[model samples]
Target: MTTIATPTTLYDPPPSFALVSPFLYRSSVPTSSHLPYLVPLHLKTLLSLGPELPSKALQQWCELQNVRLVHLGRKRDVVGEASTWKPVQEELVKEGLQVLLSRENAPCLVVDPSGVHEVGILIGCLRKLQRWTLSAIFAEYASLAGSQSRDIEEQFIELFDTDLVVIPPLENRIDGVRDVVNDPPLLAPPQ
Candidate 1:
């Protein structure tokens, strides 16, 4: 039996800034599946990120708070390479994007677990939309650990030539053991 976490609190829904949300769906399948529980996405906001990256904790947090989590990738490569992160195949990009376009009126949040390179790819996909707006972007900040973090944050800002906020790392307390996501976006409602 799959155990779904019960929601805890309420948060103001972010406006249709660009895309992202919460509601819940229960399934008989094991929770080990990477595919997140899909809520009705019609005109609903969504949050997406690079492949893998253990976003389940953040996803659950969003669900409990009524924020929708959109699963965009199914493979590790989709997250982009950590060393030379770049966009994947056109088909892969389109596959992930189909979810976003499915709800044209919806706003989305693109969280990059692999840092600037993945975010760059995400931005590239958004640009292809012809008529899409990026309300806000939150880059993952590994920590206050010397220059490495700064370099990654700077790269992320420079990639889009926009201001970027660094979100603290997220730990997967939901699953057994302490699995930590190096960089997970902070869940704050867009103004």
Candidate 2:
């Protein structure tokens, strides 16, 4: 049986610009590189950091929220107002969101994760239009919990570059990210 924690049941951390609410930060990654926490990422928005474009909207959002994007690739040419925070497009592709922009050889910023099913459909359609390689499971939760939440969170210290936080619902705050990912896959069936 899956125990789903309702929105009302979440532990509301004291307000510290850290007690992230759902309505705030779209791709709400934490500023601090703290351990033992959950970090919620808006998979779709993350996809936006792509082939490269004027990331004014994305940059402004990060700056205002005081969050940092952990770049996974070597830095590239950062022209204009957007600061290139390194690249994680490779990881995104690995997660199964076929980056067509990379294939088209065009510079675009296309980021949106409606759902795994939705992403799958997108990938399937893209396959028809171009020669695209299959990606790994794309839109799964990046959880930081276990039978002992703290132990699981501790284990992720090296994996996650930011303070892991949860944002509930599809609202994309700290709540949704941790709320479902705290244990196993939130919607997975039982043994």
Candidate 3:
């Protein structure tokens, strides 16, 4: 009697990797211009903020830049209720983040143009992101003295190996610091 061998199909093989640009190894995305390179035109960006809406000027800028605005400010649609993002925060970490990692899919940028207390929690939720760094985190009113805000910055430094860049805002607000758009330096890992 002869025995025959059968092909095994218990487990699927991993997908074959494709060639990526050598320049991609660099810390930051290679661009023609030196100024902070915003997300590529190919990808649409979601600009999220607390319950309040962005200013008319800012909204116009985002529109011109082709960014989609999302309001993650309120826990629910009810009015006069305490504004909280607890409900959708988990979904953002699980579903929202994965989508951003996909180049074919557009990424997101959470900003608190009015800069309120909730901004700290937003930053904390953002810290959980693994695949991609936040495109930007603009806080129109930065309260660095607060432990929560400082913790957020510390987390960025530990994970990204670079300080959160504070980008100047278009218009000045109550305080001298117009905004706190923390753009990742996109720097190479230190040798």
Arranged by lDDT with the best first, the candidates are 1, 3, 2
For residues 1-191, could you state the per-residue lDDT of candidate 1 as single tens digits?
A: 99999867433332112222222111111122322322233324343445563356665655664655665545445345534532344434454444433434143444444333444444443442322333232232222122334444334333542112121222311111111234334465688
TM-scores of all candidate predictions against the true structure: 0.36, 0.21, 0.35
When sorted by TM-score, best at the front, the candidate numbers are 1, 3, 2
lDDT of 3 by residue, 37-97 (tens): 3333322544343455655654665677676655554433455433542322333333333
Model 1 CA lDDT for position 74: 51
Query: Candidate 3 — which pairs collide?
Result: 27-186
Minimal lDDT window, size 10, model 3: 17-26
Model 2 gets an lDDT of: 0.28
lDDT by residue (1-191, candidate 2, tens digit) is: 99987775343321122211232211222223311122233222222322333246545554454444323222123354244332222233333222332322122122222222222232332332232222321111222111212322222222332222222233322222233344356567868
Q: Model 1, residue 72: what's the lDDT?
A: 55
Give stretches of model 1 more than 4 Å off.
1-44, 76-86, 131-191
What range of 10 consecutive residues in model 1 has the weakest lDDT sum? 21-30
Candidate 3 CA-lDDT value: 0.35
TM-score of 2: 0.21
Top-TM-score candidate index: 1
Compare candidates 1 and 2 on TM-score and give the better one. 1
